[model samples]
Target: MNVADDDDPPPIVVPEVTVTAGGAVTEGAGAVFTVAAEPAPDAPLSVNVTVGQDGDFGASTGSRTVTVGTGGTATLTVATVDDDADERDGSLSVTVDSGDGYTVSSGHASATVNVADDDDPPPIVVPEVSVADASIVEGEMGALSPLEFRVALSEASEQDVTVRYVIRSGTATDGLDYWGGTGQVTIGAGRTSGLIGMNVKDDILWEGDETLTVELTDADGAVIADGRATGTIIDDDD
Candidate 1:
């Protein structure tokens, strides 16, 4: 009756399986993966895979199981996606799923970005103004050229100012009268000095003191500063 079975129980049959995983990923980011498996020749098989944090796995082939032929190999490609938003500072991570007879390996990469402010204020300075060589002699005939004096200004400004010079003969029966021309001068901002000249003519030569007055005016024509110079016109007979 079936004479005691022998020969290692007719060589027990076993199934062979293989799995491979791969995909793109980022550090501190999320990703998805797909897994595939191959079964031993003429044997039934199944594949199960797991994903790491921020990781996902899915199958693309119609089925997760693959039938293998005699002495043949099976292959499967996994798809992964990263959705992490916190890694904006610049870091990346990639992960893979290991199932069946497969090995898993992970890697990371990174980049950097910077931000800054670019606004600043301009420097400040004080405004100043003054006159140089403020005095001049009278009737001396070029003894004191009015053009030699000047007005100085510091820093730019829109303020309007004028310089004027006048000469009046001493109180005499024959007071001298002459066209001194325009005695007005304008001072430009940031300018070291501005020049002004004067001309005088005498109808009668006198032997008394003559007065030369220099005045500075504001935009409203109001006197702001005044200087005077005096000298005597000697008679030629002396």
Candidate 2:
């Protein structure tokens, strides 16, 4: 015959816990967190969980209790708050809290959820710059003629815009008919137009009316639209 031994039952072992995110999280969108246990818990386990966010993230539940069934895995939906304010990308964290029936893993106890900003940034726009043609009359005897050309922009800029102008010979000769050279014209901030000056030499010669070209290129803070303009030198000695 066998007698029953007077002894206590074996101690219950707790399951190790780990937290992981299901997918991506973004503003105006929600996400899920999976709490898993190793070895498939024999009985239901109650685990405490804490959620946190920072930067541009929205609101979320602070702390709650989750149940892990015998299947060893449980999931919870984490709600995200939405806002219209433009912001940068944020982060979300879910941590497994120490509880009675569960043990937190040293490496997998917490999980990070990257939250993306849904609000769009302002659009980038650059104004277009253009130049207009003008004519100057050659004065009799020895005199100087002022040929002023108009350079304009499509819209006013917050900063100064620099436009490069190069003189090209068309029907006129450089240094003989007019001051032909390359230079830059700067349109000041909040201004829409600027003037480019060219000096035409006056001489008592029978030279006919001639034309020259001014080309705009390499404009900073703006785009060149009407890049080329014609300058006419009216002959007064003819």
Candidate 3:
């Protein structure tokens, strides 16, 4: 792109400067460059843009003082600094390399910036809980699919926790052998496991094997996974 015509009598009017970029940003986030001080009207000129790095994606190449206003365009910005080391996407190299009246043309001078990588975010897991045990056979009759106590998390629940349970009496007796409550169990968001719903009753009279106890008291965001759970109701007779 060569443009210099005022009837070509004014020494050819040469003022070439080129660079452009935008898209692919992250890492203290900041990227934008479109410095084009070509040979147009020949009025405003002043360029000082030098930034070049190949260690890959920022280590140098950042400086600016462009004012080609009058439609010649002038905008340069590239900034990134934040590392925890874990990368595989980086690039940087912008030139107008040196400035003084400007004269950098042979293919728009220079430009290349495509960066995106900000690693280090994953650490917050506190969990240790387990509750699971059940067996039912009370001559089936009404509601018996309940008796499934299992709340486990040895480690994995970095957020969202509401575990609170109670139902004790190891010798069974709460309407018979199952169907006792004291609520709340929602362990989600990077969860580890959760489930507690007891219900078992279809009796006439014959109590043989019965034991009940499910305990895991308190947790409003995580930190109550120490353990306790027992459920068994077996007595199907005539």
Off by over 4 Å in 3: 1-47, 52-58, 64-84, 97-99, 113-131, 134-146, 157-187, 196-198, 210-230, 234-238
Worst 10 residues of 1 by lDDT: 108-117
The CA lDDT at 131 in model 2 is: 93
Clash count list over all predictions: 10, 0, 3
**lDDT of candidate model 3 versus the reference:** 0.72
List runs of model 1 lying over 4 Å from the truth.
1-126, 132-148, 154-183, 187-190, 202-204, 219-237
lDDT of 3 at 56: 53
Model 3 per-residue lDDT tens digits across residues 16-93: 778787676776666777888766436777777777655455555566566776678877777777677767767665
Clashing pairs in 3: 51-61, 52-61, 128-225
Superposed Cα deviation of residue 7, candidate 1 (Å): 41
Strongest candidate by TM-score:
2
Error of 2 at 91 (Å): 5.2
Top candidate (lDDT): 2
TM-score of 3: 0.38
lDDT per residue, candidate 1, 128-212, as tens digits? 5444443333434643233244555554455554556544333322234222433666665434456655544443444443443
